[model samples]
Target: MIDFWLAAGLLLLVALSFLLIPVLRGRRAQLEEDRTALNVALYQERVAELQTQQQEGVLDAVQMDAGRAEAARELLADTEGVAAPRVSRLGKPLPLLAAILVPVLGLGLYLHFGASDKVELTREFAQAPQSMEEMTRRLERAVAAQPDSAEGLYFLGRTYMAQDRPADAAKIFERTVNLAGRQPELLGQWAQAQYFADGKKWSDKIQSLTDEALKADPKEVTSLGLLGIAAFEAERYQDAIDYWNRLLVQLPPDDNSRSALQGGITRATEKLQASGGKVAQAPAAKVAALLKVHVDLAAELKDKVKPGDSVFIFARATSGPPAPLAAKRLTVADLPVTVELGDADAMMPQLKLSNFPEVQLVARISRAGQPTAGEWVGRSQPLASSTTVPQRLIIDSPDK
Candidate 1:
């Protein structure tokens, strides 16, 4: 029975080899035959035309003779002196050997290594499901195997996010940033993770990250939206307006997302109006009881020659838009500089900084050095030597 099976296998192998080798040769032969037939037809037509011209006397004898010679040269070159190129019997041996040997060698190797061991594809597939937990473990294994893969780190971070583990997600995103510096996707992911980790504080750090992301891709809607939220939180009403405005420009007019964004704007505008509608009238230049430091004017007191060149002043209700409330650039820098509330600076119209309460006062020589700008000299509360006194501004009640 073994001998009969071996003989039958050999017959099957030989039959397969015969069928495979002939198909290649047959296709090649067909192409060569077609080429030969086409060339023959073209040459015959040229020769017939030449003969017809000579008989009809359309061409003189010399021209007719020349055409016949040219036609003969082309015909012989194309046909290449008789039987068209045929498949070499010699070429048959290599394919015949490859067809017989390759499958046999492959089958032998597979039988020795692959077939002997049963592959549990179901178990393997089950081992790596789309669950974030399993995916994270799989990513850890893959990254451990190949530490330099950027893709592994990126996907791993995404998996952590999917798992609702922002702390772990932040760590993975940090790795991605270290490996691939400042990629837009990495920046956005890192920002999202950071935002979550910060107790969902969309106040300061979120805006910083959002700015970085927008710089990376100006059209990033998510970043822009977050930026609007940050502005709203920080009481930057006009900034909130500008951010949402740019976003609206890119979003489709009919999109419901627009209405959602408009709701944010309406809230911010109402907050701004509630805080203190545009600083209606500039405060009096020489208010008798307030002290203020002019940041711009203080810098001008460089290389101090005299003692009376600079003055100290306090501002009350100073935190709002910087320029004219009506201007387009309604962005405000850090304000509510707490100098002594009732000081001599209340007199100068140009140094009119006020709008806060209980601001105590002090003064220094800035002693003989290039008199630093009064603004850069650092203002502090009365009786407090340092400027680190954190003011809990009632952002909700600006007039307070």
Candidate 2:
């Protein structure tokens, strides 16, 4: 922020210099005009003396004529260096007043409309915070600087939850959902925060939030975990075990959270048996379709494209929503590499290649990181969702 202010001050000084230079030049011009007038007055006085001497017969006509010629020469020599005064329709006072107001008006306008707070926020975020409390403070300032930013609000809400400030987290998450739409993940986050803020008491609002999130994505991990926790607290051990078992199915094999969730299920099972309740075990997980694909850039565009550009490869349903079922991101430099798209890579739990009867493969190259709009694209005809053959796609055409 100090550096930014210094640079801004330097620019203001440069602008002031442009305004003051003309006024300073006008002063120098006035000095030249005064010097010319002084010289002319001296020449007039000398001529008056010459005329008096002639009138009194102290000098002859030829001597008077020589005196007049010498006086005229001396006057010409004295005034020759003076330049013509420039005409200024805007006189001295106006320029001086403008010079004063320029900086004042600039500072006023900048204070009213400039992004100084955002500038400071950007500089603050450039470095890592030494503590979580510091991080939360920075995020709070960032959200204040950009009140309409959903991403910043969401992160701030998460920070509040991390700090055990559930009441604040609930408010922030509700605002986030309002701005970003009630997506499953955001809804789940809001529900969890609200539940905790209400002293772990379940209410219609929290229930509605969780139900809505699950309705959109049944395997929303946060909602599942929160429901399991709520069920356990209510002494409904079987329900807790069931909710956790469902969550366990959605986690990746190598996920660190899987072990903890499994431990919770084990504890729930013991509690259920001790309470004389029957425990129904959850069914084994089903593996979704895994499609292998090879992506390549067109030979003609090899030199025209940047190597750092983003490339998105995905499979979308042929007869459903526009969102990709499973997607992967890579760079142009990673082209010709093979990638696997499966339920494991699902962008959402409810959307997977196996859930769609027919799917199309798409690969897009975008410099701006937008998946839908890009410079180049490649697509495959509708294929069976369970297709076992490896597919090859070349980005050989414009996106339009």
Candidate 3:
């Protein structure tokens, strides 16, 4: 920040020089004019002295004339090379006043309209913060600098939540939603913050927010976690277990949060059993639909493709969204491989194999490694998602 201000000050000085230099030059011109005027007066006085000496008979006409000529020559020498005085419609005071006002007005307007606060905020964020409080202060300033910045507001809300200031977090999250639209992640955050801000009390507003988020994306991690927490707090252990288990599947196998989530599930199970209630299992776990596929390249086209070309096998709903419900990627070198696609292999939680009644199976060979568009493609007729039969796919036809 110091460096930035120093650079700004240097630039301001450069600009000021442009305004001040002209006024300084004008002063020098005035000084030259004054000296020229003094020389002219001295020349006139010397001429008058010569004329008086001739009238008193102290000198002859030739001597007098020679003296006058010498005086004229001296005057010419003194005034030589001096420029004619220029008339300025705007005299000394106006230029001097403008020189002073140029910098002052420039600075004033810049302070009123420039992004100095944003510049300072950027500098502050470049350094590692000393503490959470310092970091919060920086975020606050950032949000203030750009009130419409949804990303900044989102992070600031999270920071407030970490600081246990739920009310502040709720307000920030609400503003973020308003600016960025009701995205599932933001809606979840707003609901959780609002829930905590209301002293852990449940309200229709919070419920509505959570419902809308989950409906849009069942795999919304924040909404799932918040729902689990809310249910656990309300002593609905079975509900908590169900929500947490669904969330657990969405996490990667090696995620650090897996152990914590599993522990939560275990706790919820124990609580449910203690209350003489059976723990409900997730429905998807009971009858998960699995489709087995054997993929191979047609003999006629085998020589046309390289061994390293990519192969994509997927299932999509016949009459639903175009996005694949389950998909897998392999290479042409792995042809004649048997693979399985199931609910566990769903591309998105909301678009699982079990959610669709019927789907079409497809296998594509792509030299460019693209999944949707490929070099050669094959597809199976629509079949029940729960079919246990193994289907065969041959990549024989050129993709349209």
lDDT of 3 by residue, 308-331 (tens): 999999999885667899999999
Which candidate number would show the highest lDDT if scored against the true structure?
Answer: 2
- Could you tell me which residue pairs clash in candidate 2? none
User: 324-394 in candidate 2: lDDT tens per residue?
Assistant: 99999999999888999998888987688876778899999999999989999999999988989999999
Cα lDDT listed for each candidate = 0.57, 0.91, 0.90
Better of 2 and 3 by lDDT: 2
lDDT per residue as tens, model 1, 1-400: 3564476578767767675857686667777788888988998899899889888989988998899889889877887745556646756566667777776876687667662222332233356576666667767877765677788888988887777888888888888888887755577778788777776677465567666766545545666776677677778887787678767766777888999888887787788788886423322443343332322224333433243333322232223212211101000122223323332333332122232223333222322322222322333344321233333211111111
| Backbone atom clashes (below 3 Å) for every candidate | 20, 0, 0
Q: Which stretches of candidate 3 lie over 4 Å from their true place?
A: 56-74, 254-256, 284-400
- 1 or 2, which is superior by TM-score? 2
Shift in Å, residue 202, candidate 2: 2.2
Q: Model 1, stretches more than 4 Å misplaced?
A: 1-145, 201-211, 251-259, 276-400
